[model samples]
Target: MKELNFFKCKQVIENNNIHIWLINLEIYKKEINNLKAILNSDELSKSEAFYYRSDQERFIVGRAILRIVLSYYLDILPKDIVFYYNHYGKPYILTNTIDSLEFNITHSNEMLAIAIANRSVGIDIEYMYCGRNLEEYMESLFTTYLQKDLRMNTSEEKQKILLRLWTVLESYVKATGKGIRYPLSTDIRNIVNQHTKNLINSNFEISIDTCFLFKKIEIKDYICTCCILEPLDKFIIFRDEFILELPYYFEKIVR
Candidate 1:
């Protein structure tokens, strides 16, 4: 990953490509005030409503960074970015012109990720190294929904596979514009065997349709999945560690 310093926040998008930004939420500790300043009223209210301070910080930083990153692509001020939600509560940018930009956000532990693509996309990350708690999560959250093929290996291996499966499934549903509001037990069987045949063999690819493809991202100690509306092999994965900086326009006084 290359470290870049620039005059203004900038991001580039390519045809049929997705850019995944891995952001370290801990950096928000010192810049919390500056981060909060960039958020809109709605975002600020949502951040302030978090019960835990850590959650609040994450919300503020996450939403603030989301706006900042999105602004570059939209050629708008971060504070001017507008969002509207779908019937299933999936958020979309409100634009006068037809926009193909699509994005998804997911956070695990202190790490947050934002995926931007020109087509439908969804992303999820899971921290499965939570000691014995992972076992409890598997039993309580995933055991019953486990597909026949995913029920392999010992306890530890099973938990890892379950987390991977969970991320893939969740990302798939999110990509389809249905968030967790959709029950997993009823929807779990929707994934075709041929689509997830690579999953059981420890290969990560979930075929949503002829055009949509899913792949697992290899992040140390974290399970992440991304679903995009393009052939997986056609696009190359570019990894970059994002460092949040206040946009230059935010520093200028608007007369």
Candidate 2:
């Protein structure tokens, strides 16, 4: 009876699902100056350290956007939110108003993805541009995603498949806060093999604490993966009346 109840409880959590906010950086370019002021001195210095102008802008914009998203739930000014880093260098914010809330961020080029859930979560997105040398790119992929016979798929199709797989691998490390030290050489091909047919509901093992779910989000020309530490059977993309400006405020989601 207890075990059955555990599954039932998980089902309830799944019904609530993950909340993701997709930020399109291009739309916010005109507000860069406004976003710049949202950063604290520490973040300003870090942003300045980036060599490229574009890189600096991304750091500032990404930080500001993350805070704005959190501000909605916290019912606070975005600039007042304080962030602390865990041992693995993942950033987290604390709010006495909310409990059991966890979030993660990932960005590639102009697209930024933020995922929030009731459990530890990590999110990753990759713009699928054909800039990588096919040979070198496939070398990094696990054997399970690679074809034994080179004739299995067209070059374009293969790149999409392998690149999508890459995001899943990345989501694991990010979700774990394992950082750069985690083995990038891990061949998830075999582990992911059993779960590929149902990408959104995929679950494979890395360890007891690694992940309870691996999910794919559909965004054209980009591959996105989200990993959650606790099983959630469903997810929702949050764009209901969202604005790139300051948060519109929201009720506290977690208790």
Candidate 3:
């Protein structure tokens, strides 16, 4: 795995026409209080900014990490980057300068990931063990074909396969920005089959090529997946290599 260069802060590829940067949120908060300073403002207080659980905090931290990465990439102050929400409530940049910079982000366990391209993109991550009833949930959440696939596997292997399929489905949903309103029982194997056969769904007319990008990483006991809209050839994966040193401010509040 190639390590992303956070210190260099900018990556340029003329031939590929892609730029990517990664920020480890743990390191980010410790190295700079920029995100906290921005969120502390009275304006953002009107928004849902606090979560009662650590999982929610991790989500916010992942978003903050992306903001910091983009700030460095654009050479703009973090506070100056304007954000607005879509109808589905996904946050997106509001500047013309960002028109060409499509991005998506996901977090699982302690790691945050962001993918960028010059076109539309979406990403998703889920903890391998979310402490839920996997068998029951799959029966209700997946289509008949997907359920059949799961049933063919052993108990332990089924759990791992479930996470992998979950990431792929979640990525598709995120990419569509439809959230969970879309029917969970909808045929997913159909989509996967289309991808395999190079066929298009006539109703949606979505090209198999435009449908999904999937990658899975096993981190400790967790499985993390990243999905993007761009062609697979356009991606450059980077795992953060730097050690994180905690700042007293975060430690004080967290403790």
Worst 10 residues of 2 by lDDT: 1-10
Q: For model 1, how does the per-residue alpha-carbon lDDT over 132-204 read when each residue is reduced to its tens digit?
A: 3444443344334354445666777777776776787778778878876533555445453334446644565
Q: What is the lDDT of residue 156 in candidate 2?
A: 74
Better of 1 and 2 by lDDT: 1
Regions of model 2 farther than 4 Å from truth: 1-16, 133-141, 144-146, 149-151, 180-211, 245-255
lDDT of 3: 0.52
Compose the digit string of candidate 3's lDDT tens values, residues 73-172.
5666555666676798666675554446656677766667676666556666666677545567545654567567658878767776666556666666
TM-scores of the candidates are 0.79, 0.77, 0.69
- The prediction achieving the highest TM-score against the true structure is 1
Q: Following a full C-alpha superposition, what root-mean-square deviation does model 3 have from the true structure? A: 8.6
lDDT of 2 by residue, 1-255 (tens): 111000110111233478877777767666788887778999999999999999899988888878777776666677888999998899888778766567899989888889988777888898889465544654444344434533376787667666666677678777777753534434354444544334423343233233456777777778888877765645767542244433432222331
Taking the candidates one at a time, how many backbone clashes does each contain?
Answer: 0, 0, 0
Tell me, by lDDT, which candidate is best: 1
